[model samples]
Target: MQGSASSDFDSIPEVALSRIWQEGWLAPELRTTSGERVSVIYRGVWTHAHGPDFRDALVDIGGRIVSGAVELHRRSSDWRKHGHDADPAYDAVALHLVLCDDAHPPLRHRDGRPIPTVELVGFLSAPLDDLVARTGFVELGAIGHGACLPTLAGERELDVRAALREKGWERLFAKQLRFQQELSAFPPAEVLYRGFLDMLGLSANRQGMARLSELLPVTTVERTAADGGSKAVTALLLGCAGFLPLSPGEQALAGLTPAESAEVDQRWDVLRQHWRLRPLPSYSWTLDRVRPANHPVRRLAGFAGLVSGCAPDGLLARFSELLGEAPAAWETWLSSANPPFGSARKRQIQTNLFAPFAYAYAEVQGQHGLVDWVAALWEQLPGAVDDSVAKRTLRQIVGERRFPIRRALDEQGLHQIHHQGCAQLRCFECPIAELAMRYEQPVLYHVDEGIRQLQEEIGHEASHRLREG
Candidate 1:
């Protein structure tokens, strides 16, 4: 490794170069050969493996900031020798760091996004001692997931919130159109029941739930509501889902109380004979990676209670009337407690099921005011409660910063962006990425200090979790 002297520029080892970044000399005030100053943040989580030398680093060129993997080389053209331009794994690279400056400022990944190149020619400096610190945390791995600080930093939180709200409203209407398509084949009542039951699957098993709804049919449940109440409908759903216990003592139904387990067994026995229909076999129910609360049986019970209480008119009508009032109006609306759908899950149902269908109903009837009111109600509901998706994506973008999601609409927007933008790398269509592209200075990260502060504030639990995620 060469010393970080001016004469030693060409011979600087890649590791010594990394020390210069870790020390923050290459972070600010470095200019491209075209005389445009560059700013960088989160020199990126260092990688000892192949592919990009740095993953998820943020870089600012002129006024725009971008985030992605970063490749380091002894010379600008080494990337060509390495053939990274043809590699899909390097497609997300935000910046390319090289020791020697070259004419090629625009590098294209195999996927076609142009990568920004910044040579540390005028930025490197002599270290006070032999470069000994391992630069950034090599062992801790990626602290956060995406480099979104630069993207989100360019705008006011209000603007981001507004964009998120708009996206959410847009999604609401999109759902309306999708629900309307269902309206063409089935009655509105059947469509409403289908919407409610499908969400029981909670993304993973939604198709499975929808299939079960078809097998039992909401019409058949309505027929039994008078004689058997919710218990009969629950029996029908659970039996059809193949989730009914073969025995009261079955381990699969272990969480249920003895009485409740007996009820499931008793109900299934009577319903099995009454319908003379064979269950889909337990194999039909998807339990893989499923949480207990969202298990198909519990969700079926939850829907059964709603269905049993459903007005003689229809579920759509009930939901429409409920949506017209404040969220608190339905406080005691649901009565299933085996696995209680708490306040968060209740709000989740409102956002995912109630709001969209309410808006759809309003549109079909030309109730513009109801449409606006439902949108307003949607705005007030809290953002998604689970930390699963937003936390992961937001951490990747913002790094150790607090998760930026606030409104339920915002969480939906994040999901939309993640699905539509980040996954497809459609930065041009993404507001966040578009904002990042205009940033004068990408969020510059002081890796050593940031780590110290993050650890000091939340301690090792967060860091350990951050790495684990």
Candidate 2:
């Protein structure tokens, strides 16, 4: 893939390009491929989410100060290749940056608005190779190493742990408040169902998934399931989602066996007439690069399974009962789910959907006892530390050093810090920054001692795991 003149630019990697962008290594005055003058007021937050590489960036394009998302690629063609052309999330993209302007007809958003494209080669501050050499290979979308890391590195490890835990509690409270706000607008069950649907889509197809939830709400799904069964629920969802293939051949093309296809279509045939919700266009989904298991089809199937399994109990009541039960039981149930969602996805649903919703539901019902239970459950829940943002922020906060992310609280704290401080470029007001400032100078002895203690702690954990295994 790396050869020829354009291929040379291809070899530079998107991460390198992002680093250059973050470093502000572009020429003083930049111009798009169409010769429009472009000015960089703010590069935006490097949020590696579903849509743009950078969010809420400020740019001056031909004297107009435009505020929107910014997307970067090695080649302009990658914009379409990555399905951004169809994704509604990219509609807000104000600017597109690329090394090669290979895309014919220029770039346009999903809404057909023209996106200003900047080819970096002509706008570089130095030779491409030299600029790449200077920029190195920073992680794509990672915020820079925390300015507070050095001062915090020298403090007691206990202090650092306590700080993260405090931030974690703050994050939990924020989630609770957000859920409560939604509860005010909608019933608890519907709100929770909506949240589950949103979380199931992960980053890529979240918008489409949320839209699906709104169209086929909890009340509708429950009634449909009660009347027909899980098949009815699955059929209703897939039909609305635009995934129920029209014919046997299309079903085959979509990897559905004849029997499997027939069973769903049979139910869909009956349901479609009664529930005439407008189907989402296929383009609304980002289906190309997603793993098979995490495919929207399987996620919808899993959701249908949840509805049928819960039955007359309803989602909120069943999940609240699960919350009171052992955490292992919940994990086991999720693991053994009909579609079998992975631990990571399961943890995501638990952390983002169930826990916050449970807290909100309990508070609205004035179940004072359950409120305290949910708070305790949040503390003990394992964090989804594998999340890219969590991993990136961990490195930003701790540098090359290793720190155990033991609880969901720890992960949530990292997320809170990232959204509020690092991503916003407001390090001066960060809690870690304030903590670092409390100690005027680095304590060499404490830094060394902390490192030693961390090593011993990690070794002990490994040994304990080995014994258990």
Candidate 3:
């Protein structure tokens, strides 16, 4: 194996470490820093949440089998630097794995007991660089031109758009119904808050973000902001979200000002104890290749600001009123002049959070006019995001035709079609497929056959993996 520079070890991504763990590439029988032998039983599920990297992992430490969370970092000092020491979420951590043991180990847990540490620098099956390369991630590939592209491009383009708009309305109604269902159980403020968090979470961390909102409810955020102001709100949300660093040194490294760092550290200490709050699990956030402007920490900061801004009445009342106000007012309230909270993200917040929620709340109160206003507003909101699903659906339906998704409603229509048709592999049943059949009748059959073949291939791949396991 080729040797790697120490700097290479420093730069190793946490996700690579996770991949390595998932593959069981490290030496099976290992020795912890305390001289105890360790053996893997079940490596556990890769929880892409806040607390531990791997959860429910079973391991044998010196003849005693243990099942708990497993945490990983590039360096052993990251345990304290990342503030896991102060977080009760790591209390059940059974084993600590690190690439380098720069600091002394076993590292102490929140309850003061030393966690068994395994330094992987010496135990890896291949060179560090090779392992890192092997663990590299790949995104979804491009889809080819579909059978319906030619016919849909000529006379049927307008008809296709109309079809999509109809589906978009269906998608909008579905979202409104989901919000109504949520409102029936919880308060409107809570439902809106959870939805906002889900939008902020984006694609990667949506589930984890929704889970965080549930853990720290809207009422708590409102009450905390009212009592302690923005500083307190910042500490509460970021701390609970597992973004606040425990030590002043880590805070400084995280680019926090001295006063800001002190406030967060001091406030979180009191808030965690008083509220009996637990931070999300380790590795809950997906930070790899994420732009800094869209980092979970930054989004949490934006949420903190929003919480403080909305104060006494909470998000529900404030945003409901804003629905009647100008778009500028909505932009200001959502972004607060932050560049990271750009127009695109704000548009998404509107499409996903505001419109459906307002419509749902209005319908429950018998405010039919207000519901209509929200539905109208949804149509006018410009499309800000052009994601993979929209692109893929476009390729399948229109080929290379430059049919722009100009509005949020159209994008929603694309997603609705994808979810209902492409994702379900129900090509023949799709409205788009029906539209395609009118032009090139064989297009629907070919598309349906292609989907069937893909499903069979997927089934075979899954069965092969199962048999190997």
TM-score of each: 0.62, 0.62, 0.61
Deviation (Å) of 426 in candidate 3: 1.3
- For each candidate in the order shown, give its overall lDDT on alpha carbons: 0.64, 0.76, 0.76
Per-residue CA lDDT of model 2 for 213-309, tens digit only, reads 8788898888887788777887888899998764654453334567877888888888888877777888879988887767788788777877877
Q: Show the lowest summed lDDT stretch of 10 residues, model 2.
A: 138-147
C-alpha lDDT of candidate 1 relative to the true structure: 0.64
Question: In candidate 1, residue 117 scores what lDDT?
Answer: 68
Q: RMSD of model 1, in Å?
A: 13.4
C-alpha lDDT of candidate 2 relative to the true structure = 0.76
Cand. 3 Cα-lDDT = 0.76
TM-score of 2: 0.62
Candidate 3 lDDT over residue span 1-469, tens digit each: 2357767765565767888999998886888977899999999998755688989999999999999999998788878777777889899899999877777555787668888999887788888788887865321111122545446655677788887888888988999999999989998888888998898899778877977888898888999988887778878977898877645544433446777877787999899998999998857888787766566677776677777877877777788778787355787687672224756778888787788888899999899999888878888877733678878877777765677788888888888888886775445446676666466555545555655676687875433332211
lDDT of candidate 2 at residue 399, scale 0 to 100: 71
Tell me the tens digit of each residue's lDDT in model 1 across 27-118: 35777656777777667886645577778887777898877887776676666656666667878777777766553555567766655667
Task: Tell me how many clashing residue pairs each candidate has.
Answer: 10, 0, 9
lDDT of 2 at 326: 40
Model 2 bad stretches (over 4 Å): 1-147, 150-155, 246-257, 440-469
For candidate 2, the per-residue lDDT at 99 reads: 83
